[model samples]
Target: MRSSRARALEATINRLLAGGPKFFVKDHRAVSASGDPLRYPARTQRLDYEAEVAVVIGKGGRDIKSDDFTSHVWGYTLFNDWSVRDNVSFGPDFAYSKNFDTSATIGPWIVVNEGIDPQDIPIECRVNGELRQSGNTHSMVHSFAALGEHLSRDTTLWPGDLIASGTPKGTAVDSSRQETDGSFPDTLFVKPGDVVEVSSTLIGTIRNEVVKPTG
Candidate 1:
């Protein structure tokens, strides 16, 4: 799938290709959120991993017909939408903050979109090889088709674009709690030296190491 940054660049290129003036805009920039200029911002500290069924768009258009959405889907890939609990809470409605560089760890591989239905897929997340979160794609409040239709209402949909369904009910924080004074250990926030592994019955597993960015 195409990265958000790539999509924006294509927009400028398209305009210029069509004889329009060259006006450039970029969306994906690396920045920290913790208010420490010295400390790089983490979009999530509790950096949870989600096992999501991702749709790769094959065709690009504005106002894509709802019935035709499936035809435009190129395939499916496993996506770990890395979350920064602290950063997501601060702004951009949890979406943009979560879409940072190296934030989107995708594709051990892609499954063709033709044979399987997207909604029936099962998903789960594990920490250090133990199960922490589990759910079926059927539980999603918004289906892929619906999300695509809604998104196309105002914006163009591009090939390689992604529409990640929101995380399921059992993310790390959902299963943990804080003390009365509101303090939590490194466990409360995923710290370095931890391994986050996520899998689905259909898609298999994707694992990542949790580490601190060096100063």
Candidate 2:
């Protein structure tokens, strides 16, 4: 997404060479991202929060041209791709780390794309009212249109599909807190009672409190 564009491209290039993107399908029936507690299925050591800008697809198409991206886009919204990072130990699959119920959240509302300039828009995330991420859409490596083009190459993007742009620097696992051993300190993650908010003037704010999971 636009969020990762600000970082050095070396990491991006290497990631592409590794296997392509780290994507996993979400179980729509189990999604309860907002107005619900952001909880953990188990006692995950690193319950990471990914604040992002989600692109709302209005029309469906396959092999879309980037220049025609605007015609297919419907609107924009906020997204949080919560992750149970340490859970990757099960087998390194996103299904293990990302597909849990309530692991992700989507908007309080949508801002339709009528007279909007998607780029250069401001975005940020905060925990307990403390700012942790601050970046603009200008840094996005790929425009929403470009993402639409690349993503729809193999499959059709139907109406209601959401594409979450990447999270920005200062994310819980961002390099700022990386240890010499290449591990993020335990303090960087979220815990019960933590209030996380992702927002932007172009879109709107979405806040949630972390709580213990229920059966």
Candidate 3:
């Protein structure tokens, strides 16, 4: 749980926080194909995978109550919010670091069922068949209902809009940096020829292969 990069980010956020929490919107261009090859950016030194669950909206509404979250949900699916670690710096440029084409991977398909519980499902990430990250929704710091209500407070969540739940802690950087010195493991980060898969019992799996950018 104690990551040098995370600690550095925490320190940076603390200095910028005047009072409460903050959220930033990402451009739609960041989305990528779920089964397509992940093109490694020529400029980044590190491309990391963040295994997460994605919630798809079924209806459009504002100021939606937490209890009404279920009615608004369309389904659940897998997502990998890829990160370019080297592109990050003090006071981070999230847009520049995370908005690359094919950066946000989603799907395999959506599971639309009212009986599904988002709070206790198992989630994991594997690189080349080796488990890299593992955790359950029960450990999520924020509940899906709370997130839905908070997001709809000032903005409308339309049908088809995807809301990605935050990722669990076993990222490539986290494992390498926490277990060894603060250095990143060359084998951990996604590089050309690597296959990354994010899976969950509730939704299924999303697999992608890393490849050099042809353009």
Model 3: colliding residue pairs? none
What residue runs in model 2 are displaced by over 4 Å at the alpha carbon? 1-9, 16-22, 87-92, 175-183
Highest lDDT against the true fold, candidate: 3
For residues 36-117, write the lDDT of model 1, one tens digit per residue. 1122234445555556667788898778766778887887766666666663443345565465555665565667744878
lDDT of 3 by residue, 104-185 (tens): 8988899887578888778999999999889887766567887888889888999988877777878876565443654555
CA lDDT of every candidate = 0.62, 0.77, 0.81
**Whose TM-score is higher: candidate 1's or candidate 3's?**
3
In candidate 2, what are the lDDT values of residues 1-215, reduced to their tens digit? 54443464466656644643445666675455566787765758778887788888999999999899878889888888888777364254756677777877888788994587777568898999989888877776666777778889989999999887777777776543556786668787888889999898888888889888777
lDDT for 68 in candidate 3 is 89
Question: Which clashing pairs does model 2 show?
Answer: 2-140, 5-141
**Weakest lDDT window of 10 consecutive positions for candidate 2:** 15-24
The local distance difference test score of model 2 is 0.77
All candidates in order of lDDT, best leading = 3, 2, 1
TM-score of each: 0.72, 0.84, 0.85
